[model samples]
Target: MEDLSIQHVHLELSENLEAHRTQGFSNANALVVRRGAPFRVSVQLKGRPFNPTTDYLRIRVSLGRLYVLMPVTFSRRAPSSRWSAHIDPTTSNKQTLFISICAPASSPVGSYRVQLSVFTQDRQRSAANGSFILLCNPWCSEDEVYIPFEDQREEYVQSDSGLLFKGTPMNLVSRPWSFDQYEPGVLEACLNLLQVSPQHKRNRTKDYRNRCDPVYISRVVSAMINCEDDRGVLKGNWSNDYKQGVSPSKWTGSGDILKQWAQSGFSPVKYGQCWVFAAVMCTVMRVLGVPCRVVSNFNSAHDTNDNLVIEEYYSETGQKMNLSKDSIWNFHVWVECWMSRRDLGSEMDGWQVLDPTPQERSGGVFCCGPAPVKAIRSRRIDLLYDVPFVYAEVNADVHTIILGQGQVVGFSKDTEKVGSLICTKAVGFPRLQNITGDYKFIKGPTSTISSMSSTMSEDSTTSRGSSKGVLVSLSLDKSPVAGEPIRFMVKVMNKQSVTKRLKVHVNAQAKEYNHSPSDTFWENHAVLQLAPMEVTVLRNQILPAQFEHVDEDILINLAAVLEDMSSHERFLASEEFNITSPELIVQVAEESIVPNKDHAATVSFTNPFPHPVSGVLTVTGAGLIHGKTQFRMSTLRPGGRIEQNVTFNPSMAGVKMLQASLSLSDRNIVIRGFTMVHINRV
Candidate 1:
């Protein structure tokens, strides 16, 4: 087949031949060729001609996967001229190697370039170039070239054994000399065969003529055999010890043993020749009371020649065979078990494989290595599990698991501590719990005592001085209004003991309200202080006022904190009130007026209420000014009046009507009247 050149060529040679050649020839050249084609390639060699006796040349080709090295022996006479090599047509042509790349036939057709090198051993020099392409058959059907085996046949059969196979059992037979089956005493025999003469038992299948033990064959057959009769197989009751209570009579076979193990707490472990280990593990688990069975004839990469090749060895008979690496023929094996109600539907149920000896060294339990369980600690107690006895030394009053090493895999259902106390106070503060009681106070003679007494006498002899406890009272005339000042008075006297070093601090809350008119005038204020037993009156303190037009309610609030000067302890008091304008009552002072043409007319208004008056005034029915007239009056004194006037020129003839009215601040109130006047048109 001719190649359709399509691949790119990359140069990787060391020497530049095109520069040294002088015969109108260039060494820097490129070539493109398709795979599987006979082609000729030529290149000029630098240096003297006809030195072939000692010098040798060779070509190397690398098409990604295909590598070919060809030695070229040029005639000793023709060294200076262009050297050429023709690839042979045959598959075994030394100069032209055949490459049967086994890629999926469905692989996309494209061009792939490879590198070509020319080297001289004596000179230790080399030069290289390459090109490549692949043309796929457009008429080829994908199904015809890459048909899936599942769609072709329900199952496959071994031609030599006449046994039906579904998966990869036949593939194992292809390497007949490496693996085989055992007949009667399959379990014990396979075990003995594996242990005593592992090499001999392994080579039993080297020759097709050798008869495999029926017992070993039976074991293989057992993998395919399903347990219809639950006779000896343990169905459920995973907690039951099959070894003691349920004897071997309860198990169908070694497969049943594996199934039991799965029901308990076992899972599959995979490695090289995993099936062999799985089978052995199933038998071991069955003997250990776990119900299990094997799933046979499964294809797995673990059973391939890669593993077998590494495990290959010679027997005493001088025959070659793979050891346990080819343990389970081509067929894979797994165990399925019927879990008890406790484990049913749990992760422990279903099919599981046993741990196998590691094909390579590992660092964990169940393998040929150390246990990973290093240390353990209890949540409520410090219990060391790795050491001899399980004892707890330091018990955590709190329900917590603290481990020095390892992790908490499980926990017990119990509590140890009820409550915990955290210290939040500053470092200098004393840490104490549950405090209660009262303290006594004493003063030195240096402290001065002030005494004031009030006396009341009836008609009689002079009243004797009576010792009585002094009563002090504090009171305010009214709660402070926001934006307005507050007046306060305090009275103090000597009680059982002369009260000394007493000071009152009044701190008012400065607050603001939005949207609501209530408390709109409250402002935050600083703290105020008062002397002991001192009568003091304070007034006219202005508070800030924040007003929002949206809400019609007024808000007023005040807060004060009183502190004892001696103890530095303080007490707080607050007062709140509201400031609101009653629904506004507005009226116009003047109603109507009859003024001579061109004379100014005046209007007057009387506000009988205590509020500011504001509105727009208009004159209709007559030719008044073009724009409207507006008036504003400050919060009028009760029964106050305001006046205004408008002068107009009567230009039209006939009887003209003059209507004038006062706009009231209240939308519901309007004082209006009309007046008629005879006018001549100007």
Candidate 2:
């Protein structure tokens, strides 16, 4: 008889990672592989050839208290949702033996310790130890998060850079974001997010078990993105004040936020908005092997009472008031992840909405989602995981009212304003893909205003005036831009066959993109006299000096009100617009970009304001640059232009985006721009 003791075990990291499509994560020393796939390991014997009938082997995989032990046999079978092990007959010799191990597709994703125990006649003799990290499998058909399309998998799971749509639907702005899932310390930080979660802290075994499902994982990540409940990743700030920490707008990538959180001993990163929260959540999901994308809902409503309606109040002078708790954001961002809803049936399985912003609580925690998109489209609010909340966000009706002396003077119902548009980044492109049809059915415009009673007596008013009342319309003469005066026109028409004395009031207020209007920035008042059937067009311009002190990227609410001097009748029209910041020009000098080859690009900025301006220019790209490059730009006078050159080497092959942002001094403004580069494989 021979000892048949195991000498050493080798993990075929390169071969297994290549097969698992996780080659990008090979920077770690430990073996990294996706679940539901088989990985090879070789074992060397110390003494003699092992006979399968007498000498046996058992493989044990464990994470904390949860462990799975399986007998090594000659059974060469297809992999399934079960732990199995077998010796490779073709590679086994007298001194060394090759073995393949498979973790079930439903296995809990995390680091696992692999141990091989040798036995002779059921008695333990020798053992060997190894380790590997297991992640969710989007490429495996057996995985619940499996996506069939290759292009979509590459875009959602593999691509480290993306675009977040902001601004209004009429004027869409593609804000570039670096997912940076594979950046140094980013993947580790993503895993650390799970470790710091309240669920994992409460019960490690149960949390590990629940991670096998994408639904559980999404819910946990959603709550952990905000610091309201747990010591999460980012702190949300919508008050336009970021003195203590970095502003949410300054973040161009998730790598810095994640690393900051981890380095600070699980403290929350400062200042995040809706888009920032969604972008960071998308990065964590992608790093954990879940297909995810950020989505923007234009005119998204926050129905506080679950009534499927949002009430808005306005003053008699057309100024919007914050009297109601419910509000409508110009745009609200959230993430949609691809996974199967076994708990909600196959029909409900598909893209599910997971909002990371801490707007509301679910299941006694500040987490929301795993709500199926189909369920929301079907108006099935009875389902689990905050379906009614998301349903109201996109399908709620809006009631606009005007109050005078605590009485309703005017009222309008707009059925089409809420969720006018929904979109996400298109696959393999840097453009917007309209997904509005997925959330709701298209209906005809249904905005109607109730007839208001004339303040004048019937005998005093003409039939035409009583029938049509006063009609007011507002229009923008040109797109508003920073350092340029905003020009717009207000048209007021009188239909009565009588001379009328009227008072006109125009108000402009600066507001955050996701909140209600703040204090008025500019206003105008005038007295006008109109003859019978006469139209008045008032052209107005708000100079850059008037709003230069206002915050950057904030929307301007320009409203006009016409009051009948005698009748006391009021008509209101308002428009919400944003001042477009000057964009940087990023031109890649290389005609063809290949992996590991140096490339040069230029970042240019021209001062459009009349005064001198100085700022810091920061350039970053996930696969194109090593980290981020920052340069302090000197003060440039009016009409002065400056160009900074950047040179870097591409690390991987894929479609990469180079993004630049200029943060100005003496003002709160951030100008951003990006250009796409297709890097070919070396």
- Choose the strongest candidate by lDDT: 2
Which lDDT tens digits does candidate 1 get at residues 125-157?
544455432222111222111112321111110
lDDT of 2 by residue, 115-175 (tens): 9988877585899998888999998999999999999999999988899987766556779
lDDT of each: 0.27, 0.86
Model 2 residue 554 CA deviation in Å = 1.5
Candidate 2 clash pair list: none
RMSD of 1: 43.9
